[model samples]
Target: MHLLAHRGYHAKLPENTLTAFASAVEVGFEGIETDVRVSADNEPVLFHDRVAPNGVAVAALTRKQLSEVCGYTVPTLTEALDALPGIWWNIEIKTPAAASLALPILSDYDSSHRLLVTSFRHDVVLAAAEMLASDCGLLNAHRPAALSTLLHAALPHPNLRTLVWDCEIVDPDILRQANALGFRNAVYGAKTLYEHQLMQELGVHTLITDYPQYVGLLPG
Candidate 1:
């Protein structure tokens, strides 16, 4: 199983920052997952929330303004990739505008094997599959109406090979069905030892976890 550090191994550092990403690499994780949002000046920055704690929208601030407000540098998508090369990246486009802003930057890089762009918004994944050089995935938070139904709708796009489900919704049958349909099973929110054990037995392809160090020690 491939273990991806969620938010760049942020257990000890600020998430989506260069420091956090470097920390993930330092600890030897193969890949890191991060979120992308477009700032007011049209720069694609690494941030998770749509609104700041101060009730300001991330899109309403420039990259510099965001850094100042957050008290840390909000690295651009380009900056993050440039700073950490040769590591696999799971870039989650947080907004439709972010997909447009981030895809061009991703295209300029060597992305075919090293990048996977995903989103909860299926529309973003649909649009990205047409234009992106990297692989695309759909992130679902709950169990769909039917696993086959989801695969049938997604299989038309050849690049959409991964089904990122929340761990709460995963079961052996669902994982088995998804695998039979040629989809890679990836999940997040597997926090406990039992959950990790369950994921291992189910043979998940990827585990996007916040506690990479803890999960890395588990028998897979």
Candidate 2:
């Protein structure tokens, strides 16, 4: 399985920061997964939650104010894309506006970002696919939900590419079925060695985690 740093290497730095992403790159990760939302100015920015650390809505702040309060520059999607050149991305769209706002920015990239644009909101992911040569996927908290969603998405669109599953909830059957339907799958949030070992045994090709360092040290 290919290891994707979840929100970058946040064990030693803040999640989703450029510093974290750079650390992941330096550690030799093949992929990085991050979240995106549209700012008040209609620009796509990297942010995991709608609420900021100090209880302000992330949508309520401009990019400048966001940096000030957070004590670090939270990268815009444009910035994240530029910083993470040559790595595959599983960029999760946190809202519908982000799905729309991100497409134009992504189009300027050389590789369509080597991206699998994903979202918990089905409409948002579908909308992204409608807008570009989208390698898009639906995100679910578990494998069963993702399988159900895949059944829906696969029936209508052959372009659908991946399902981002919580590592705790994934199993061999889901991967088998996903392969049968012509989509790849990725898993996230595995924090233990056993989980990583299980994922490898199941033949997972992509995994997301907070500690890419330990996972990368495992038998490949």
Candidate 3:
């Protein structure tokens, strides 16, 4: 089982900021989950939302211009790789086009040994699996009803390694079913220490949490 810092232990710093990521590593988290969106220049930047600070959509601004307006520059996918060492990355491709922008970066890192590409967009995940081929592990994010659809779409690909389930959608039966399918299951937003521990006991192999320290795996 693994404890992942959601948005890099967001309670300790701004979500998705370098400071937050570093704090997660310093606190002994093995994996960090972050989101990726493409800038106008088609550069893969680490940001979850499509809208920028000044009310402009990210699609409308060049990567350079976006950084200038947002104050904190968006870190490229490569920059994240350079910033965090030894820790595994749960990089979520937020849009269909992001697969193209992120696939090359994943290849350049070529250390698929340490990367897991995930996406809520099944098409994007499938495209990335095809693009990266056997070079990386792919994870699909799904709700209960959509799980079967995701499985049918991704099972033929050997690179699709895991399934991340929404916390509210998870049940004991589903956990067993996912395990039978040979996919590891993960839960997100275990808000407290007890909740986190209980989820681990419930056979959740990975947890994405805001309070990493509360999980008792990191220094509070």
Itemize residue pairs with steric clashes in candidate 2.
none
For each of the candidates, the C-alpha root-mean-square deviation to the true structure, in angstroms, is 1.5, 2.0, 2.8
True lDDT of residue 144, candidate 3:
52
User: Model 2: how far is 153 from its true place, Å?
Assistant: 2.5
lDDT of each: 0.86, 0.79, 0.75
Worst 10-residue lDDT window for candidate 3 reads 133-142
lDDT of 3: 0.75
Candidate 1 lDDT trough over 10 residues, lowest sum: 211-220
lDDT of 1 by residue, 44-63 (tens): 99999999656899999998
lDDT of 3 at 95: 84
Give the poorly placed runs of model 2, Cα more than 4 Å off: 110-112, 143-149
lDDT of 2 by residue, 1-220 (tens): 8888889988879888889998888887888889998776766889898998889988988877787888888789988888767788878889877877776776676355687778899787777777657577878785565566456754566566777788877778888888787778778878788888888788776888887657656786
**Per-residue lDDT of model 3, residues 1-220, tens digit only:** 6878888866746678788888888787887899888888888888878898899988778889887986776788888888885788888888877777887778776544377778777677777777764322344344557457657877878877577876766778878887888877878866667777777777887877777666565323
Candidate 1: lDDT of 55? 83
Instruction: Give the Cα error of residue 46 in candidate 1, in Å.
Output: 0.6
lDDT of 3 at 219: 24
Off by over 4 Å in 3: 133-142, 217-220
Q: After superposition, how far is residue 89 of candidate 3 from its true place, in Å?
A: 0.4
